[model samples]
Target: MGIIDNLEAMRAKGQDSALMRYSLGNEYLKQEQTDQAIEHLAEATGQDPNYSAAWKLYGKALTQASRYAEAVEALNRGIEVAEAKGDAQAVKEMRVFLKRAQSALDASG
Candidate 1:
């Protein structure tokens, strides 16, 4: 079976967690399916509000979909969650994405 098939099986087994949703979201992002990625990533973040990785991916997916304002919001929240969790790497990475989103907004405006 494919990656998505496996993920679907896992989900059917009630193995739904933040990490599981994040993995599905990342896979969608890899395929450039931003809407699907956003849906899965939103689930992940909802499952675990402190899931910095999910938040990061969510922001990126939003940016890819040309939702600059939403991307900025997700990135800002991710940065805060990362900082509070002492995830230095996550914080740094999200900040870079946040700058990209901000730049996009500025360019459009």
Candidate 2:
């Protein structure tokens, strides 16, 4: 079965696992299916809004889809959440992504 099919089955089974959703999204991303990646990543983030990795991937997908503004917003939210949780590593990584998003926005403007 395809990855999406598996993910659908998992979701139907009430397995709203953030890591599973993130992995599904990563698979979609590997196939260059940005829309699918975005959808799964969004679900992952919704399941665990404090999931910095999901947020990072979501922001990357958004940026690749040329949703610069949304990418910046997602990255910023990730940074804030990480900081609030005192996740130093996540915060540091999110700061890098935030900088990239900010640069992209600046270049677009």
Candidate 3:
């Protein structure tokens, strides 16, 4: 199995490693598997709710999957996480992404 498959297997086995989930999500994203990416990234975010990067990636995957509403929600959560962590850069970046996702959702509706 490939690295992502191995990571997924580990996750299924209850590894619950946030870093591993994020890594697997990134690999899935690279392969254009937005659904799998979203799944793993969501798990990563759940494992560490304060992880702004994982939330951002999850938002991105949701957006790519054409789930704009969910993307906006995830981005908003990411922004909140970043703000709570006092990460100015992450907050700023997440705000940008959130706006973009909101726009996409608006356009779709």
Of the candidates shown, which would achieve the greatest TM-score relative to the real structure? Answer: 1
TM-score of 1: 0.95
Better of 1 and 2 by lDDT: 1
* lDDT of each residue in 1-109, candidate 1, tens digit only: 8897799799999999899999999998898878999999999999999999999999999999989999999999999999999999999999999999999999998
Q: Lowest-lDDT window of 10 residues in candidate 1?
A: 27-36
Candidate order (TM-score): 1, 3, 2
Those runs of model 2 whose alpha carbons end farther than 4 Å from true positions after fitting are: 2-5
- lDDT value, residue 23 of candidate 1: 95
Clashes of each: 0, 0, 0
Q: By lDDT, is 1 or 3 better?
A: 1
Order the numbered candidates by lDDT, best leading: 1, 3, 2
- What's model 1's lDDT at 46? 96
> What is candidate 3's lDDT per residue for 1-109, written digit by digit as tens?
8998787788789787889989989999999988889888998999999899999889989988989999999999998888888989988887888888888899999
Candidate 3 achieves a global lDDT of: 0.89
Model 1 stretches astray by more than 4 angstroms:
none
List residue ranges in candidate 3 displaced over 4 A: 12-14
RMSD of 3: 1.6
- Cα lDDT of model 2 by residue, 18-101, tens digit: 999999899989899999999989989999998988988898888888888999999888888888888889878877877887
